[model samples]
Target: METLPLQDYNIYVGDFDQRLSDWLAEKVYSRLLIIVDQNTKMHCWPLLEPVVSAYQHSLIEIPAGEDHKHLETCQQIWQTMMEARADRRSLTIDLGGGVIGDMGGFCASTFKRGMDFVQMPTTLLSQVDASIGGKLGIDFMQVKNSIGVFRNPQAVYIDPRFLRTLSARELRSGFAEIIKHSLIADREQWEELRQISDLGKVDWPKLIVPSLRIKQRIVEIDPFERGLRKALNFGHTIGHAVEGHALETDAPLLHGEAIAVGMIAETYLSHRQLDLSAEALETITDFIRRIYEPVALDPATFPELLRLMSNDKKNESQAINFSLLPAAGSVEVNRTASPAEIVESLEYYNEIVAVGNRI
Candidate 1:
């Protein structure tokens, strides 16, 4: 029911296959390209294909992973779009996770100097979070969202039905963003998620409104991300670094898993330096452990991870800034801590492990 601020753009968020197809037939431009990852091409495209068939739907598939969100990958996608002769009248319907949504939006925003993009986010992560916001970009030098632009989509189509095809890990991954959203703005929304008997068995109708309202309100206030918007990066500071590192290696964790760790570690920072209550941090840590595989970050991988974080684009000069949680539903930004503080934060994170609850 929530609509994007931009005119001529409606974010259709329920079961409306016939209406979606009918609307696409009426509103979308002439050339239609459905950008998707291989996984979505296999799992979700089947359901969406028929709806947009009339607009000369061109299926552009990229490799399904974070490693592919680079200039090289964009080059390939650009070539494919050109091969299809996508013009200004064309619309790119991004049909995948954040990688697809971000890259596809960027591709459309740049190619031909600007084309309309409609997000068709498949994963719970993208639907509830990434797909809506106008922040579009690809990774640069393996940094998370390092190369990109802030171009809103023509529309964002989030169908909960798509979540049925996602792997359990993928669902959990997106839920991290959901948790981040709730933490930054709405405690009641956080409680709704916490009380859910099954995170996977989400009540789509009951859930979509609060999440959309929160994100839309924030974006409306700070579309350019000059100040208030940076708060959205709460779990992302360390989460992004972890994501970049994992991508450098073979065992890359999906973004959400890395963020689950990021949230815990950043919460540690908040607990020690900021005014966040320890009880709330424990509740968050417990929730995360229930959903994700506990990553026991040993001392050996500590320095490299820390270095990767320093190299992150979010840093100002030599100091790395973070959107640390002072409390749930409240974030404090640019609270740059020293490297020693970061190490201590990691140690503090390890201490929070359930082995013997030091606190």
Candidate 2:
């Protein structure tokens, strides 16, 4: 197993069974609180049950999906922990995708003034992106990650074997972050990624390792997100807004799906403001369009989308804050775009989708 050591923790990316068993044996916590949703409980639990079943642990299963990621679900997790008689010395094993990792970690971090937690992310999205950041929270007031805290997990165990359970769409959803990581930091990796036509045939461990390294460098430098860490938000600002708006609709977009839209729109902003070449913009938009399903924004929803962006946690002032690309493999943070320009970018996204639909 290859390990990427962060300042406070190590992210194990490979077969994690032995590593996890060893870690649990070494730590020997007073109790173990294993958090899972319906999905993970069914598909992922079996893989983990063998190692952890030997320990004294309580299983807390909640509903699955972004819709369930709220204060109400947190209350349920907290109540279960209370019933389990959990204390700071106890360990929380967040064994699921991003929602479970985020909400579970948030619950553990805040429980009795904080208990130790380890991330055993089961999905591709969670393994490469969500599990590593140390950013934990639930969606609130229709704002993505509006309520969160920065606290590193004791460790992160990413076993790619868990990815076998994902649907094709879900796997594609996770690929967006890998795309984002390459675009923002690794130009060469981006070149390698755009060439990928089939995810099933691809070797994930090779891709996940480098992607983790890119994020590791950034998060370690600016864990508080004061400056350098903002670079990681390259596609998140607008992506979060799009994601938040979609959550209320009949058809909601996955986190990475929304970010794919955000990346295209922000790439447009990059071309217009930062003078990124038209060729680069086309390369990005075209590649993303080929990989993800096209999402057309309603003109009527522009007002609400703007409102969501306005209230983004990254905003330091009245203007919405964005992290835009000046070029592939690099970014500029603390950037602001006017409302009209923001609408224009959204329109650009719609126009492209409309054109693609026609063809």
Candidate 3:
């Protein structure tokens, strides 16, 4: 097992059974609460059950998907904790993807004025992105992660075995964060990533480590997103808006799928605002397009997209904040783009998709 130590916690990546068992033996929580969604309850819970069942634990399963990430579900978790007679000494084990981790951790942090929680990120997205950063929250009023807190977990347990439960679409959905990590921070990794044409053939554990390291460095420097940490928001500004809107549609986009779209549009912004080389922009766009099927945005929803972007957490003072790439492997945070310019970027993405469709 490989352990990556953060300021106060450690992220254990690899076969987590022994590590989880050892860690549990060391902790003295009054009780353990394992949180899951419908999906994880079936697939991920079994992997965790053996380790945690030896202790005094209860299961809290809720509905799955991004649409359920709200105050209402948190209430269900909180209510379950209450009935379980959990206290601040209780430990919450968030054993699912981003939704479970975000909402579970948020619930734990607020319950009884706060309790300790550990993340067992089942999905690749949570393993690499959500489980770290100590950012916890649920979406409010269709604004993704608008209501949340910055509370570190006791530890993070990332077991690659959990990834086996993921469907192809889900696996691909998680890969967007990996792409984002390389794009913003590691040019060499980005180059290496470009060689990957088949996700099924790639070694995920090897890829996951580097991506985690990239985020580790950034978060360590600016934990609360004061400055450098904003670099991580490269695709999220537009991506979150796209994701929030898609959640209300018949065909909802996964977080990473939506981010793939955001990255394409934001890459266009990078080329326009930062003067990124056309070659570099094209390289990034083409690579992403090859991996993620094109998702065309409706022009009719442009106004709503803009409204969502305006409410993005990263925004400073209504200027529609962005983290633009001046080039691959580097980012500029706190950048503002006018709504007109933002619309143009969205149009650029649509045009690219339209062209690709024709050809």
Candidate 4:
């Protein structure tokens, strides 16, 4: 097990071979609650039962879906913990993807003025991005992860075994973040990832080295998100707004899918607004389209999406903040954007992708 210590924070990440029960035996804890979504409860918990035998383990299964990322769902989870008699000494084992790690972390962070939690992140997205970061929160009023706090976990056990069970779409969704990570930090990793073809063919152990290195380096520079940490929000500006809008209604896009488009479109903004190269923009857009089908935004939906962006959490004042990629490893924040300019950028992105699809 290669352990990486997250300093001054409880977050411990590792490709751990030792069982969670054995790890927990060293620490004094009152009880254990293993939280899982409906799908994870059915597919994942059986493997854990054998490993977490030393503790008094209980399962708290919640219905899966973006609609459930609300205060009501969180309240129910808290209620269950209360019944389970979870106190400060108790721990939460978040055993699933981003939604599980994110929402579960929020519950543990607030439970009894904060209880410790471990992230047994299943999905590739959660393991590489969401789970590793101490950002824990739930959606509010149908926004994408709007209500949350930055609280580190006690441990993050990343087992690549879960990738075998992921559907192709889910696999593609996670790869998008890997692409984002590469774009933000390591240009070499970017080129290497671009060379990757079949997502199923990847050497799992090799991929984590670059991915975690980028996140750890970024977080270390600015743990409180005062400066450099904001760079991680590269594709998230419009991506999150689109996610928030779609999640509210009939169809919702995955985080990576929206971000794929977000990164492509944001590339245009980066070039025009931040002087990023045109070649790099094309490289990112082309690669993302290989994994994600760009959604055609109707004339009606585009405006509503913009409205969501206006309310983005990063916006300090009334200006919508953007993380523009001027170079491979560099980004700038607090970009002042006009409504007309933002709309034009989205329209231009659609034209490029639509032309490509038709060809």
- Candidates sorted by lDDT, best first: 3, 2, 4, 1
Which pairs clash in model 4? none
Candidate 3 local lDDT, residue 297: 93
- Number of backbone collisions per candidate, in order? 1, 0, 0, 0
Candidate 4, 102-185: lDDT as tens digits: 999999999888999988888878878875568888988666778999988877887777777888778777887788888888
lDDT of 3 by residue, 250-270 (tens): 999999999999999999999
By lDDT, the better pick of 1 and 4 is: 4
In candidate 1, what residue range of length 10 has the lowest lDDT sum? 1-10
Instruction: Tell me the tens digit of each residue's lDDT in model 1 across 94-167.
Output: 88988899998999999989988888888888887775568888888666787788888867777878888878
TM-score of 1: 0.92
Best of the two (2, 4) by lDDT: 2
What are the clashing pairs of model 1? 137-148
lDDT of each: 0.79, 0.91, 0.92, 0.80
Candidate 3 has what TM-score? 0.99
Over 4 Å off, model 3 = none
The prediction achieving the highest lDDT against the true structure is: 3
Residue 353 local lDDT, model 1: 63
List, residue by residue over 190-256, the lDDT tens digit for candidate 2: 9999899888888998999999999998988888889999998988888998999999999999999
